[model samples]
Target: MSTTTQEAFWSGEFGKAYSDRNNWTSAQYDDFYRHEWGITKTQMNEDCLRDLPKDAKILEVGCNIGLQLRCLQEMGFTNLYGIELQHYAVEKAKEIVKNVNIIQGSGFDIPFKDSYFDVVVTNGVLIHIAPDDLPRIMSEMVRCSKKYVWGFEYFASSLVNINYRGNEGFLWKADYSKIFQENFHQLQEIYRKMYPYVSASQQGNMDYMYLLEKQ
Candidate 1:
């Protein structure tokens, strides 16, 4: 059983619905990334993960359907792993992404040893975590990573709560990279990119991607 409401919500039917909606193949996501960011998803991964060995062990938290892990696989990273809160998503991921291990798990308590992976990542996942719960999940990411922590999430200078699907307390935006650095003294921000919404009316809305190396 999930220990928190947020975890419960994500592990239940709602998360399955989200997984269904985002069931894009790696090639499909390549096109979507090009349309949304003017760069391929593989290019974005290469930008942040450059210089890492092809056999470097990588883990993605909340890897719904394993699309990002598939992207990493396409880039020649052989040792890959992912954890998803939803069991349905984990099953779906296994069906689509080969060789990578995708398991049903939670970020708050990742089922791995400390420094188990060379890089630990989350894509558009943290925004759903309540602010007070962020540290627990972030700590798990840090604990499991030997060298790097990567994240892509909605960005705002300060905490901004937004109603999601007519439900309150389900989503938020904040300076996640800044927060991570503030809490984890060992982390140093190595790279960051902000991609604003493509439409003019949503100009102010943007997503932030960041890489932090542990020293």
Candidate 2:
């Protein structure tokens, strides 16, 4: 599907569905990361903050409910900013992290100056975007970061078909090494194992946490 069509579909359907109480819950969010993604707040903090300089400026795309923001704060990261599309999630985030500078915006159109952040982080956000928008969004990510860009995303060799909540489409996976080489040098890649409880249909599914430094 075209980018415009995909954006419209997501803005209306997936966004609303996820923001709905019946569709999403705080417990589900915690469980998904802890059980499904195999992430802990400590691990998330270390992964994002280790290479970053003290008091570095950081931006997180599609940061839901500021869970990671709390983690960043615990790691002594002060200059943190985030962009999230869902209003409900944004509101919840504000309640948890009062000092966070969270903006309601699209990942493809981040509202920040070029090279404004020392690091840019995103987790599980890329899967929601349509395949065609990936390049543009990635460019935006590169444009905003001065030093490094870290991402944890779901991967498949090619686009994979999935159906959920009246939305059906293929999620694309790019050759990260190839793509990063075009604009940055890869520093590290940490692969996270898939959870056992995930459906067999999602077998072979893996999450990769990548760290890239601008060339």
Best-fitting candidate, measured by lDDT? 1
Model 1 residue 71 CA deviation (Å) reads 0.5
> Per-residue lDDT for 70-180 in model 1, tens only?
888989999999999888998999998999988888888999999999999999889999999999999999999999999989999999999999888889999999889
Per-prediction count of colliding residue pairs?
0, 0
**TM-score, prediction 2:** 0.76
**RMSD of model 1 against the true structure:** 1.3
C-alpha positional error of residue 139 in candidate 2 after TM-score superposition, expressed in Å: 1.0
lDDT of 2 by residue, 42-130 (tens): 56557645766768998999886787776677668889899987676778778777788998887788889999999888876666666
Candidate 1 residue 90 Cα shift, in angstroms, is 0.5
Which residue runs does candidate 1 get wrong by more than 4 Å? none
> What lDDT does candidate 1 reach at residue 169?
87
Kindly report which residue pairs in candidate 1 clash with one another: none
Residue 162 lDDT in candidate 1? 96
User: In candidate 2, which residue pairs get closer than 3 Å at backbone N, Cα or C atoms, i.e. clash?
Assistant: none
